[model samples]
Target: MKSFRRHTESHRTDSIGWLRAAVLGANDGIVSTASLLVGVAAAGASPGTLLVTGVAGLVAGAMSMAAGEYVSVYSQADTEAADLSRERSELEADPVAETRELTAIYVGRGLEPALAQQVATQLMAHDALGAHARDELGISEAFTAKPVQAALASAASFAVGAALPLGIAWLAPAASLMVWVGLTSLLFLALLGAVAARVGGASMAVGAWRVTFWGALAMVITAGVGRLFGAVV
Candidate 1:
């Protein structure tokens, strides 16, 4: 049972890597692009201008998402590498201290001191680096941070999310484009929220309605502002 459970957790750990960023990136793309379209449409822009704006938003947003993810993940990777190097040095210079350190970690985790020391001894015997990496440095292959992959995944997801609003704009009547875009985009936001919650092991209904409410409110406020400006002008 323990072995089986470990295997399941191992896989779950890997999925958490890209899955979190992908979902978030997609969510940003959807919300931002949708909001942008709603705002522009509310401004009573021409269909041609709206289409141009939507396309531009998609491209620019995707690039921005990808670049931002890459830079942020790169920093994490650098920090991990530095920590790993420090661990390696400590292991080489003072193996005894490192060993005691591992024992202390186990003790902190609720193990008896004698038992913790014993466990550390056994694990170090099998793989010293592995023991420290898991118990001290807190690094794992399953949870490795890959900057390039993260960046690409984020950008791709953002593009997918941004595309929804753009597609809505294309099909909508120019005269009523704002209304259709708002409604359709809100639907997408709700769906995205539910799906994200399901993937992240959260409450589906709450997630759906939360996103729906915020998205609707944003659209409404933007529309009102646009109408006010139009009336005043």
Candidate 2:
């Protein structure tokens, strides 16, 4: 007799939910905080003022990210639930039609009609709602909306990202605060993009360039506005 091995595969789809929230939160945190500090510094704000503003921006950004993620994800969860409920009712009302629908879906996916019908029949017999939810509605355990999880990940990542520029602002020489914050924040954004790309199985260079470009643009515009205001005032 030969020994058999049961192999399991892991995919990035499982991490999509939290990964999206975390990346968005951290990117926003770094860009917004760095821009805020650079803008203020360009306006000749005192070190004390820069520190206060950076801290305030960090706190506000984190809270906003949390609230935004929670509300949005909760709405998604609600929609998914409503869809599942409707699907369940439809399945109960006309199980035969639902089976046909599932069969059509599988057939569309390249299975022969008769084979699709057989597969759909077996799956529905085993778990009708599960079949409909997964096949028809495109909802699955791995892709389910998780509001609390998204909220926490967004909030925590935002705070951590914001802290990088904030700490630099607090420590850098007052005259060159903007320079330090801008450069360091760009580096932070690039690193974040690379890390996120690695996790999501994307090209690291592309991800880093994408994030760094936007971050740099934001800081430049903000700094220009601050300089204009400083000169006028």
Candidate 3:
């Protein structure tokens, strides 16, 4: 019995749900807020105006992330529920056919036909719905959509990420506010990317470069537009 006991181990898949939400929220918050501030500063916006704009961006971005994540994740959850419901009906209406489907799935996965049939029958006997949901539908608890969790995570991470540039903008001199916010935001994004990559078991440098590149591009374009508009005005 002791030898048969299962040992626990953690995998990156376990954190997939929250990790994705956090990374996206944080990246968007930083990039958007920083770009906004830099663009405004380039347009010769006063310090007071910059701070106000940053604060407003932070609030709006956080709320947007929360609502967006909730609706998107809810849609996924709804789809999954519908699928499970349909699967349940099939299970109840024609269990024999369902069993054959399961057996065929196992056969496709390299199991012998006789062994696949036996395995499928035993699994269905144990928990028909669960087995079908996992193997047939590719739905499991780890991948199950949780709208509330996703929304909260996105909102919280977005606020946190937005605060970095906002704080820097508040403290930095007005003469160089754009440079300060832009440089520091890139640093923040690099760190965010590296940390996210590390957690997700990817190349830190690659992730960092990927995020920083996009952020830089956004800031540059926004600043250019602001400069152009300011000169025109």
Candidate 4:
């Protein structure tokens, strides 16, 4: 007889929480900082001034991302905690009702009534709170919020993404700083989108185009505004 091996496949759903924060942070970091630099350069700012603006943007943006991510995710965590607490209270107050509720949930999902009841009963026996939390409340470990992790990921990724444009602006010639920053920032945005899509099992082209289009539009608008204001001043 031959032995058979079973293989398990991993899905990106597990990465939904942190991946979203990281990608958003990085994308915003690149687009916003680059646009700011291009705008200032268009407004006749010196290279030293551009560098100062870029550095300031990088620091501010990273901290903002981190703080925003933490607060938003912490809100979610609080909601989940409240829900779990309510569920626990309900379970303690009325075990039969909780069991029936869980059983009904399983039955609604296509399980036979008797089998669902049995399964729910066994699960509750093993861990009533866990079973209710997982099934009745739709709260699972996979989607649990980690505020600290999200904040750290956002801050770090934002800093890294913002650095690319800052470095380019620093190295490129003053006369053509705008061009270099704009083009390189687009490249970075496209790359970020492609990599994020690939990691999430989506189309690379679509992601790349989506981000680049917005980035280009933002920079163009900012540069135009800068030129207009520079003329006025």
TM-score of each: 0.89, 0.96, 0.97, 0.94
Query: Where in model 1 is the C-alpha error above 4 Å?
Result: 1-11, 224-233
lDDT of 3 at 135: 99
Task: Residues 185-220, candidate 2: write the lDDT tens digits.
Answer: 999999999999999999999999999999999999
lDDT of 4 by residue, 1-233 (tens): 99878756667988888899899999999999999999999899999999999999999999999999999999999999999999889988999999999999999999999999999999999999999888877888778999999999999999999999999999999988999999999999999999999999999999999999999999999999999998898
Would you list the rank order by lDDT, best first? Answer: 3, 2, 4, 1
Q: lDDT for model 2, on a 0 to 1 scale?
A: 0.95
Q: How many steric overlaps are in each model, in order? A: 0, 0, 0, 0
lDDT of each candidate versus the true structure = 0.85, 0.95, 0.95, 0.94
For model 3, residues 146-173, the per-residue Cα lDDT tens digits are 9999999999999999999999999998
Better of 1 and 3 by lDDT: 3
Could you tell me the TM-score of candidate 4? 0.94
Q: How many pairs of residues in model 2 come into backbone collision?
A: 0
| Candidate 3 to truth, TM | 0.97
Give the worst 10-residue stretch by lDDT in candidate 4.
4-13
Question: By the TM-score metric, which is better: model 1 or model 2?
Answer: 2
Question: Which residue pairs overlap in candidate 1's backbone?
Answer: none
Better of 1 and 3 by TM-score: 3
lDDT of 4 at 1: 100
Residue 36 error for model 4, in Å?
0.5
